[model samples]
Target: MFHPQQEQGQPSCRQNTEETDTDSDESEYNKAPDAPLTPHNMQTMLRKATTDIKSHLASELDKRLSGIKEDIESLTSRTNHMEARIKELTTSSQAHSQDSTYLHAKIEAMEESLEDLNNRSQRNNIQIRGLPEAVTMEGLHNVLKGLFKSILPEASAQDLLLYRAHRALRPQGHNGPPAFLRN
Candidate 1:
């Protein structure tokens, strides 16, 4: 239904025949025969159009601001989650580094102990190899007793032999003697 404010002969209050004709003429003028728009001029026009469009969009799409805000909030939450994950990973990496350092120290200590054991075993083996195969256990004990008495008068013969036997069984490797001996 046309309101009284509408111009005579027009069907709707918002429609104006003169305005429509003017818009049509302007559109035709925009397409007039001339040099094609240059890139620099087109870019300037595009920038101006974008600025106007953004201004119009800001005014017309005000109702969508709340939705945009919600989207921003979700993105922020995801970013926060990623930061927390990175922190967790960093902490775990540090802990793993500490664990690795401790394990390395333990391995070094074990290696030193094994080296000492190997040296002692080698000395005992040299001593045993020097002895005569015909030497009886009793003769061996007496020999050790005399040796200990000469060097360490305070040590007993039994104690000296026992120490020598312990030295002979000293470890020979990092893990132990070998798979056969370990088993």
Candidate 2:
């Protein structure tokens, strides 16, 4: 079959002619005008372009590094603040524990003192039993006066006897004779 370009009378070697034309055009354009090309000027322009690109890259890197450094410093400051707060809380907790221990000791001492007072009060309270049916207030007074003389010598025999009779008659659940009858 006859190709379209061949039928239209176009060159069969058109691709080769186009390549040659492009090469020749580029070579003509690269030829220096009146001034001869110098290695020094080419080197200077290359150095300037490289320096500008490097400077821009360096500035961008410096900005990123500065932002990172600020973030690191912020993190460090926050860590320091947290450590200080932890120390303060630890100290406060220790002080509170010490205070609680001291309060506990004081409460224990107070309880012991109250227990002693209660024991002494119980000792002072007398409970007399197995008395004869004919036991008189006078006889009871004589006996208590002799017994309590060492602790409460200032108290009268009659008062001691009356208090004892009242307590004996009202012993817990048993309500004994009236006040006048006991007397």
**Best model per lDDT:** 2
What lDDT score is found at residue 97 in candidate 2?
100
lDDT of 2 by residue, 1-183 (tens): 122344455444344334445435334435544444343224334545787899999999999999999999999999999999999999999999999999999999999999999999788676655444454666866544655664587877555564454326633335454343353
Off by over 4 Å in 2: 1-53, 126-183
Cα deviation of 50 in candidate 2 (Å)? 6.4
Query: lDDT at 137 for candidate 1?
Result: 58
lDDT computed for candidate 1:
0.61
lDDT to native, each model: 0.61, 0.63
Model 1 off-target regions past 4 Å? 1-59, 127-183
Taking the candidates one at a time, how many backbone clashes does each contain? 0, 0
RMSD of 2: 13.4
The C-alpha local distance difference test score for the whole of candidate 2 amounts to 0.63
